[model samples]
Target chain A: MKKIFLSLIFLAILTTGASAQVKMLSLPQLQKRISNPDTVYVVNFWATWCKPCIEELPYFEKLQATYKSQPLKVLLISMDFESKLPAVKTFARTHKLASEVYLAQRKSDQELIDAINKDWSGALPGTLIVNGKKGIRKFQEQEFTYDELNKLYQTNK
Target chain B: MKKLVLLMLIAVSSMAFKLADGGYKVGDTAADFKLKNVNGKTVSLADYKAAKGYIVVFTCNHCPYAKAYESRIMDLDKKYSAKGYPVIAISPNDPVAEPADSFEKMQELASKKGYTFPYLIDETQDITRAYGAKATPHVYVLQKTAAGNVVKYIGAIDDDTENTKADKVKYVEGAVNALLSGKQPQVTATKAIGCSIKWKKSA
Candidate 1:
C-alpha cells in the first residue's frame, strides 16, 4: 500500500514537472565514464533500500564538494531493480543528492560486480575510485567517512 | 623503466587479491558455533547428531537479497533435513547498525516465516567473522566427516537473485546433491550481489 502510494506521488510529480533523471547505464557506458582520463571517478555501487549505503552517500557528496575545483566526479550508481527507478528519482530529488545517480541495468548483477571490481564480493556500499590519468584504481568494500574517503581520493588523484 | 612497470603491476595484483581475501575456501573445516536460536535455545553443530552435513548461511532480515532467497533457503531445509543436512541460518548483521535486524526482529521474522530451521543470531559476530562472510545470504555448505564439518561449497543460493529466472543455477543444491551421490560438486564457489554485513561500530 505504501509502495503504491509512493509510486502514485512519484508518477504525479513525473507528469507535473521534470524529475531527477536516473539513466540506466550499460556496462560500456559505465566503463567509459570510469576510464575517462579527464576526471577521477568515484563510482559508488548502492541502492535506496540499503541502510549502510544510504549512510555513506553523504560522504561521497562531501568528497565531490571538497574537491569541486579539482577534476573529480562522484557517480552514485544505484543497484536498484528497474521497477524502483521512480523511487530512485524521487529519492534523488527529495534528498537533493549533489552526486549524479545512474541505475545499473546490466546483463547480470554478477557481471556488474565483476565489471566494477573483480575482488568485490558484490556487496553494497562498495566503491571503485579510478584516476585514469594517473593509471590508478582502488576498490574498497566498506563504509566510509569524509576523511577516510578524502584520503583515498587524494592518493588516487 | 621495465622494472618500474613490473613493480606497479605487482602492487595492483596484490591489492586486488587482498580485497577478495579472508573468506572460507572449499575443503576448509568450518567452525562450530554456540548461537541462540529464535526458540531461545542455544544451538550448535554438535546438537545435530544425526545429520550428515549442514547448510550454514549468514543472512539477515534487512537485506532484500536475503528476503528474496528466504523461501529457497527454507526449501533447502525441507529437501535435505531428513536426508541428514539441516539448514542453519545465522543473522550476522549488528542490531545497532540495522535496527530492523535486531534479535527481537529476528524472532519475529522466524515465527512469521514459520522457519523449520534454526535462525540464530551472532551477537558478538565471532562466528560470522570466523566464516569470513562479507554479505548477507552468503552460504557455506558443509559436509560432515570424521575430520569435522568440511566446507564443500561457498557462494550464493542460486544464480538468479530476483528468483524469476527459468534457467537459474542452484549452486547450493548441486553441491548437496554431489555429496549425497558420493561425488564432489563441479562448481564449488560463486559470487552474487548482496547487502554487506552491518557490523557494530568499534568503540
Candidate 2:
C-alpha cells in the first residue's frame, strides 16, 4: 500500500508540472494570441544584451501583477539567438517568470523587425499594449514610469 | 502575476543586452544639423561632402556594443573615405552623465586608434535627436548630389556581433558597393545592434 501511494503521488506531481509548463509559441501562434478576440495582450520585445530592456522588465512584471484581476496577459518575446534557447529557458527558469515567454524565431533582423512593427527602427525595450477597445499603443523605447503605465491602463479601461 | 514580478527583477539583474529597432527603409536625404566633434570643432552634415557618398555614425565611448564596432568604423573610413565616402562619427551622450563619452576621451580614443575620420561630439544632444539616433554605433550612409547630400542607408555596420562568424552579412559594405556601382542597395535600412544612447531625463 505504501509503494502504491508513493507511485500515485509521483504521477500526480509529474502531471501537475506538465500541465503548468510554459508554452513558447511560434510567430503564427503569437500573432493569433495578439489577435485573440478577448485577451488583451502586452507584448514586449527585448534582448539579453540591452540594458534598458533589462531595467524596465520589472516594471512590466509589476504592470502584469496590477492587472491580474483582468483578462490581460503579458508576453515577453526575447530576440536572443535560437541556439541560445537553452540559455534563455534556464534564465527564465532562474528568474521564475510566470508571464508567457517566447523566443522570436526570425533569422534576419528585417524579419524580426517586421514581425514587431513596420515603422520600428530596431530600438530596444520596445513595448506594445493591445486592448480590445483601445487597439494598440506602442512605445519605441523604455524608461516608462509606473504612472505612465497606469495611465495607459486607465485610458484603455 | 506577483510571481512574474519577482521573476522580471531576477531576469534583469542577470542579463545586460537590450532589443534594438529593425525593419526600416534607407535612401533618403539626411536631416542637416551641427554638433561639436571630439576636437571641440563643430561638425555638421554639410561638412563632409563626397561626390559619391558619405557616412555618418553615432557612437559613444563606454558601450560594449560600440566597442565591438570601433575597429569596423575605423576600417570604414580607411577603406571608403579616400574613395569619396569619408566617415564622420558623433558622440551623442552627455559629458556629465557618461564621462567616458566626453570630448576629451573621444580624442584620446581616436588618437590611440589612429582614426582617419572626423570624430565629432553632439554636446546639446539635439543632432542625435534629429537623426533619431537611439543607440551607440548607429550608422547612416549618405550620397552627395548636385541638389544636396542624400541619405543612402541607415543601420548596423554588419550582421555580425564582435565580427566573428561565417554567417555574417556586411550590410554597410554591400550598400556602399551598390552605390559605387550606381545601383540601389539591396537593403537600405537594417536593424542596429548596440547600446542605447544615454539621454538625460529632463528635470
- The candidate that achieves the highest DockQ relative to the unseen native structure: 1
Q: What DockQ, between 0 and 1, does each candidate earn?
A: 0.53, 0.23
> RMSD in angstroms, candidate 2?
11.6
Please give each candidate's TM-score: 0.86, 0.76
For model 1 the local lDDT of residue B196 reads 94
lDDT of 2 at B126: 67
Residue B63's lDDT in candidate 1: 91
lDDT of 1 by residue, B32-140 (tens): 9899999999999999999999999999898988998999999999999999989999999889888999999999999999999999999998788778898989999
- Regions of candidate 2 where Cα sits further than 4 Å from its true position: A1-25, A93-95, A132-140, B1-28, B31-34, B44-51, B95-100, B161-167
Residue B190's lDDT in candidate 2: 76
Q: Is the docking of candidate 1 incorrect, acceptable, medium or high quality?
A: medium
At residue A118, candidate 1 shows an lDDT of 79
Instruction: List the per-model TM-score of the A chain.
Output: 0.85, 0.77
Candidate 1 residues A1-157, lDDT tens each?
Answer: 9999999999897655533568888889988877779899998989998877888888998898888999999999998876678999888877778678899887777777887787888888899988888888889998888888988898888
